[model samples]
Target: MILTADVLENAFVRLEPFEPSMRAEVRSALDCDPDSWGGMVAAAYGPHFDGWWTAAMAAMCAGSRIPWAVRRQSDGAVIGTTSLYEIRPEHRRCEVGSTFYRPETRGGPVNPACKRLLLDHAFAAGAVRVEIITDTLNPASQAAIRKLGARDEGVLARHKITWTGRIRDTAQFAILDLDWPKVRQLLDDRIAGFSES
Candidate 1:
């Protein structure tokens, strides 16, 4: 199974391959909240934005990660970004992480729509496990992952040093291939409910 980036979309959001031209727009969207970067391992706003952008592009070019610009389908506006990284085809696993969106896009169908597309793509490409890891300090992120039907796999203590030099505990979650059917249904139902409202 060769895992590669492809355009993934649903009714609410579209995940397009991240490109150099999108750097400015994506950075502007991310700059809306400096506090949003607090729980993130790497800074993505202000002075740190350039470094983050460079590394992301390098990873994509090196085939180590597949990043996407998250666009709202209604306006074709780039609201944020996400990625499938730490991919290991031999192990049939990959991580859905590095996800962030503008403040307005949170707590709506945008997230579930994006995850549904990413999960569906990974599973279809023969992935046995898809993991979503987050900073333990960020309960909002952990809760959002749980809402997607991911099983909490506990914390990884001293997981990694954050950009601010803080040792972060990572909250791990996973949805195995065996669990996909139920998770898929849950996500679909949730997105459908959003549309209904």
Candidate 2:
């Protein structure tokens, strides 16, 4: 279960290891829609952006998380960020989370394309199970996760304390290795549909 931060990409998006040089681009992409971070436990917009960026960079530097700057393939623009964290090789499990995308990239091929690449990489690295968790208040996120073929595993009460000191409940979803083949096909078909359109 060796999960390394290698470049993972597809036709629509490329997941490159997050670097300090990408700070401005990433910040600009996130600033495009401050409202988008409403449901996020950590602040990634406006006044909180600097702190969030600092902590994120620190985490990446410590090897506590494998973070990627999600780049749009067409123009190679940094549009978002995502990570593979809470990695446990002993359990052969990890989480694909801390994901965010510019509002413009939502509701299209970007998500599926990104997920397909991430999931493929995780499983290839010997992940027996991968979890995608979201704030319970974020129905849109929950819906999107469900659309990825992840099974709802209920909510964790008072799961985390947000940056604003509010207790947040988290909805848990998971896709097991046994479910990978189906999930993979579903993602591929969805991405293909976008191209077909």
Candidate 3:
């Protein structure tokens, strides 16, 4: 396995290694964009997002070889990030999370392109089932995962305690290797449609 922080690249994005220097980019991405995500979801406040920052830096320093800061291949703007956390080669499973994007890149090609890149890599790495979880209250994220054709794998009740000291239920989603063909095909169609100008 290619373990030890590395960049994920493709035609659309050049995800860099997340570092302390990029803290501003990460903080800005989380802090000012959503403004409560149209009040449809509780916007991820900046202070609470430190967890993501810590994890990313740790991953870069000693964790694994896969965490990356997502950037436009064209401009290299630090727009967002994602990582393959809790990787278990024995189980061939890993959790893909800690994703955030700048407002400008949202509802655009960044997400699908990023996911397309990550999922493609994950499967190639022998990950039979890749899982992602989001807060149940975060309908927008849930909808996005569903749109990716991930199967609803039930909710993990009181899955975690938020920074606000409230218990949060997490909605889980997964796509297995067997499902990749269809999922990939679906994503291909969506991305193609996204690029049809």
User: Candidate 2 on 32-82: residue-level lDDT in tens?
Assistant: 676667667897877787998898878777766788889999999889889
True-structure Cα RMSD, model 1: 0.9
- Expressed as tens digits, the lDDT of each residue in 1-197 for candidate 3 is 33345567766777776777877876666676644433221334466567656755676565553567788877867777677776777778877776777767878778878888788888887789889888888888899999999999999998877655668889999999999999999888887887785
The model with the greater TM-score, 2 or 3, is: 2
Candidate RMSDs in Å, in order, are 0.9, 1.2, 3.3
**Candidate order (TM-score):** 1, 2, 3
Span of ten consecutive residues with least summed lDDT in model 2: 31-40
Once fitted onto the true fold, the runs of candidate 3 whose alpha carbons sit more than 4 angstroms away are 1-4, 34-52, 60-65
lDDT of 2: 0.89
Q: Can you list the residue pairs that collide in candidate 3?
A: 4-64, 4-65, 5-65
Better of 1 and 3 by lDDT: 1
lDDT of 1 by residue, 100-127 (tens): 8999889988899999999999999999
- TM-score against truth, every candidate: 0.97, 0.95, 0.83
